[model samples]
Target: MTDIHIQPRPVVHQLRAFTPDLPDRTVGELRRLLGLDEVIKLSFNESPYGPSPRVVAALQQAARYVNFYYDPEGRELRDKLAAHYGVGSDYIFLANGADEAITLIAQAYLAPGDEAVIPALTFGTCAFATRLVGAQPVFVPVRQDLAIDLAAMAQAVTPRTKLVYLCNPNNPTGIMIDGSELRRFVAGLPQHIIVLIDEAYAEFVTDPAYLSGMALMPNHANIVTVRTFSKIYGMAALRLGYGIARPELVAMINRVRNPFNVNFLAHVAALAALADTDFHRLVAARNAEQRQRLTEAFTERGWQVCPSQTNFLFADTGQDSAAFCLALARRGIIIRPGHGWQLPSFVRITVGSPEQNDKLLAALRELNGQ
Candidate 1:
């Protein structure tokens, strides 16, 4: 008799069975669906202005080194960032992007059945990373003003809580928590739980009362601050970001993170961009000006615009935000619908150049019939 052999089929359980329910691609797919060229994308919060001239030059020069492997330690870039932030290189860990840093933190610290507290209206990456590590995400709702409800967050912390994510000048909402309130909240938390502060948009902030997690890092061993060159630095394509924490914490993250996560061009570009102080100032000033212009325009149109301390505005249209976004897309304007953040009536618009902002306002006015 011939011996029979059977191959085992892959088993899918509830934990690994879930598929991502991403919305149909807005800009990329919309361009193909409508057969259009030159689509204006304000959907993703990318810098409207490209990278600094110095960064571009450095990228071009660094292209020659593409054949060689990048430095595994990223020592030069880390030293530059350390000097820029007035911290020691031991306190820093570089990642491909701030998003990757979030994932690394979760992998290093979180265990299955652990809890990570996040704002309900946060960037999806924060929540996704927490879940990827088999940790549950406890979403605390925002206040009526659309800012993080610190009181609720304080109450949400339990014995099993491992991480608490706070996005200053938060994504989607573009609002910030006051320094005093944040300080009180952080002080109240148990020292065992780590507070992950995402400050990707910190450079664009104008409020002096807004606390930088970096400023608080010296006092809290469990606090980790993440910054990126993606937004105001205008190097999203370069994908360079760094984290500051206690040396021990940084070491754990480095151990779990991939070696050579940052490419040669990105490393050089970030270093160049950091040295370009004038470019940084220009981008910050332009974003502030455009943010004010967009806020006033939305207010005059009877839409309620949340006060933004970031590079974007969250405007609550009286009508459905998804419908408004679709209508705006038909006119070649791409704004982000807030459905992903469970904000059905709000849309996020990135601060663009004067001409772009004017064009967006005009489009909104036409749509609202004002």
Candidate 2:
């Protein structure tokens, strides 16, 4: 082998245009890094209950046939979803994850110089996808309650604003806009602005004011709701999600979709998870109870925990978030820091099992020097 000096090839301008904000590491990697035997994984809003027993059985049975490719169109899942939402299969578009739907929508609707209006505490993926298409993201600051400031967002839209990103029970902040307010917001927006509502935590929402975007899509052609089985269903490892829109929009986004985007095992798991309504209810109830408990505990201690409808709580720790997360990691717990979101004094903590929550509280108490 000769010593060769070669120049590194630069990535394309589209890729270089923006840096994607995604988790670059895994729980196992972090555990290995800290030389810990086990780490409580609560950084992501995942179901600590895991999926239903049916999903496990179905996946176990499907494991024998890992060599086969799943249906490229994901018809079975799409048909079931269509019926679930009272829509035709043509109105549904499946993808590897909800993030993929966001990307496809941006690709289909956005061109260079276009704009996507989003909240200041917008989900990370929505911003990343918008930037990926070389479109400008016009972010409107949230209200004092940490909910999306829809009026501000509506005012920010112009002729060039192609998309509006709305995250129900938004990530990081975990606050949601009410149904009536959101409808009024949409009504005020220019018809040209397509709304991409990311509803990853929809299943966990117990608030009466919350509404599913899919329920409002029948009359509105501009509405696109992205959902996933990764949260309440505990199938994050499977990477399965979909976009619910009118037939015209689904057709348009489908053009950018890759063939066989959803894997066979994932398709099976999601299918099984749907039929497990009891399991779903159980997880939702547990999350709601735990979320309330955590919020009350934090509030009593003079911490500002935002009211959360999702399976997570965004708390003002009154400390350096990065330092707090590092401390938690060293104590065999994984959590999210808000440095990326520019809230250095805050952290987003996912509601976990009772034991996990207790362990987390203990860690917080120690960090408070109590």
Q: What C-alpha lDDT do the candidate models reach, one value each?
A: 0.85, 0.86
lDDT of 1 by residue, 78-158 (tens): 998889889999999999889999889998999889999998977767787877777889999988888899899989999
Give the per-residue lDDT digits (tens) of candidate 2, residues 1-370: 9888774432234344434322235767767788988788778777889889999999999999989887899999999998888889998999888989889999899988999998898687777778777788888998887878888888898889999999997988888779999888777777678999999999888889988887677657799999998999999889999999988899989999997888999999988988989988988998888999899988987878988889999988888878778888888888888887898888888899998999988887887794
**Each model's TM-score?**
0.92, 0.93
Candidate 2 segments whose C-alpha is farther than 4 A from its true place: 1-24
Candidate 2, run of 10 with poorest lDDT: 15-24
Look at candidate 2 and tell me the lDDT of residue 16.
41
lDDT of 2: 0.86
